[model samples]
Target: MAFPLQRGLTPQEIEFLSEMEMVTVIPRQRLEGLELLSGPTEKLLPPQRATLPLWLAILLKRQRRVNIVPPHWLHPECLQVILQFETETKEYTDTFSPPPQLPGQRRAGDDSRRQSAAPLRPKYTLDGQRYYPTPPFLPQNTALTPSEASDLEREIALPYHWLEVGNMLLDAASDDLTEPDQVRRLLKDLREVRMSKMRKRVDALDAAAVAGGGVSLTGVGAMEIGEMRGFVAGVVEGLRKIGASREQARREQLAEEGSIQGYTQDDDDMQF
Candidate 1:
């Protein structure tokens, strides 16, 4: 017996990839900076916050050397707002709540002035070429300052690795989060609500297979995509097979009609 081949990355693999996302951590002890393949880490000083990858943050938290600061979106109030947007908002009734705006992306009602005022800080490559970073490279999970947090409250959106990062922080640094229990509950509710919408949108998959048609997955997280990949692939494959069968039947019918017409024309010529 042959086993079915896997499509796309697994949830576990996606989770592992998410560990590379940068997060802010408040150190309880002093430590010297070390060079890593990605980049050199900042030296940790007592009570000073520094940005580190999620994997390193979790490791430090486990050793009681630092406390991970949860991102603004991970807060219960923010989660509540996001959940309401996903479930009750008329515009987003069928869509997932939008992900956080990318660098240099203006919000819905922003003016040109604001858009021009806030320029994106581009990262430089080893070759000194400037480029904008996305997802794991962006500091999406990093802790915000008080003023920054307040400003961000106006537009609450999850990051691409929201599920994986949230779970890791909750598991390793629950003490660092304010009302971790509520946060956990809200996360669960949000996941279920978004997943229900995903399932409902399966009817659109056939349309998505057609030219110029697609299902909007604007705010979908990495883990969610991984979870649904196999199911969506199966649905699309089945639809393609059905379409092929129908096309074959239509061609056969057309051929038979043409043959009958040709025979009639020959008989009419013979009669003439």
Candidate 2:
């Protein structure tokens, strides 16, 4: 059997990748840790929350063994705040809201006293080599405890896998989420707003394709990028072809002018 080739990642593939993201889950039963390929999961004990891969969490949730704790940004209040920032904020009117800060990144408006104390802890691999993690390994979708959530310094921006993780949790663990209906609605609204913003960037694609130029995709989610990849790529390719045509015409015009000047100089020399 032959399958048609696709340009960018399909939505299902993006969702599959999101499944590797770590998320917090509250277990209802005790289970011993099992060693698996992507590192052994901690033994899940009742009343003691553990962070596990989203796929495993979803499996346990479906089996009625655990409840997935939605990340703080998945809450309705936070979504409303993010939506407002997207629609109403003057500073972000032309750009998407910023993504979550990486470790040790200092947010704007931080006090000098507090800025010096930001932590940058690196994770260790099974081989004991230290390396900083990003995206799926960053715990961006993991639920924070009450004390940790109380910190006002935590920014409520969306993570890189926002859409996929949000949709997955909403599908498999809606009961665990606060106001799942509202969360779903807000997710839809956010998607529409961001997609509109993405489509509006068509005019800037030409400039982006030029040397030393680029369009900022800092806060775009994987699913969103997959959706827009084909259209944006086509537009950029067309722009590049048009640019090449113009450059070729300009070079021919200069060459013609140089040849004419050379012919005139030769005639002057002949007369002399």
Candidate 3:
């Protein structure tokens, strides 16, 4: 099942080579070119089957193809054949480890998840004053007059505009990143979109809470994560066991209700 780490070959080709040994050998004639590319396995298909990649059709041709694969070029896991061959040198053994999590990432059963999703209680004032659509530093009537130049900003003349300040809250959806839905949402607030939404929602809210936010609720969510993770594990195990039990009962029911094609009248009366 070894894949050859051949130069000029794609990772995809190498992956295919690994899979070949698990089922069948590729035929040399088929491997000659793309004209005869064939079955993932030979025993499963017919000869008249259209040709495939030259290496892939080797089984149909029934001819052995010799490839002087380098010791290091072959992946260790797939090269079971190399271990049996004598006078082969051993390379470094590759060991696998679970993937590392990002810093402050929440593992399963992070208790704080339930807590973080909970909405925050906003503050009442920002330095003994009521909240306003226009903060103190912002210019009065910061509207863009029709007489202004065409390129002038149509948005509030606030110093901390979202387009420049950046949003740490939103996620990107497009590959090019030109489509920011969060930015669109920010542009639609009452102040920006003229719907008068600020006072309605932030009336009693703490302004300080908004300014001094970003206390991660999900970071150490699983802080005491030790056995709490087992809660999620238990749920998965329960579902698996339930599925197995259901499958077993279904098979049993099918076996018990075997074909009744040749049953006599008495047998019919004594149904399964």
Best by lDDT: 2
Q: How well is each residue in 1-272 modelled by candidate 2, as lDDT tens digits?
A: 99888887988888899899999989999998878797799999999999999999999999999999899999999999999999999987767999988778876787767752347788788799999877887878989888778888778989999999999999999999999999999999999999998988777777667755888887888899998998888888888899999999999999999999999999999999
Instruction: List model 1 lDDT by residue over 1-272, tens digit each.
Output: 99975879999899999999999999999999979999899999988889999999899899999988899889998899889888889999998877888777887778766652246788899999998878899878888877775564356689999999998889989999999999999999989998998898898987777664878888999999999998888898898999899899999999999999999999999999
Better of 2 and 3 by TM-score: 2
Local error of candidate 3 at residue 117 (angstroms):
22
Model 1 weakest 10-residue run by lDDT: 111-120
Sorted on lDDT, best first, the list reads 2, 1, 3
TM-score of 2: 0.90
- Checking candidate 2 for backbone clashes, the offending pairs are none
How well does candidate 1 match the true structure in TM-score terms? 0.93
* Each prediction's TM-score versus the true structure: 0.93, 0.90, 0.17
Stretch of 10 with least lDDT, candidate 2 = 110-119
For model 3, what is the alpha-carbon lDDT of residue 218? 22
* Residue 37 error, candidate 2, Å: 1.8
lDDT per model vs. reference: 0.88, 0.90, 0.29
Stretches off by above 4 angstroms in model 3 are: 1-220, 224-227, 261-272
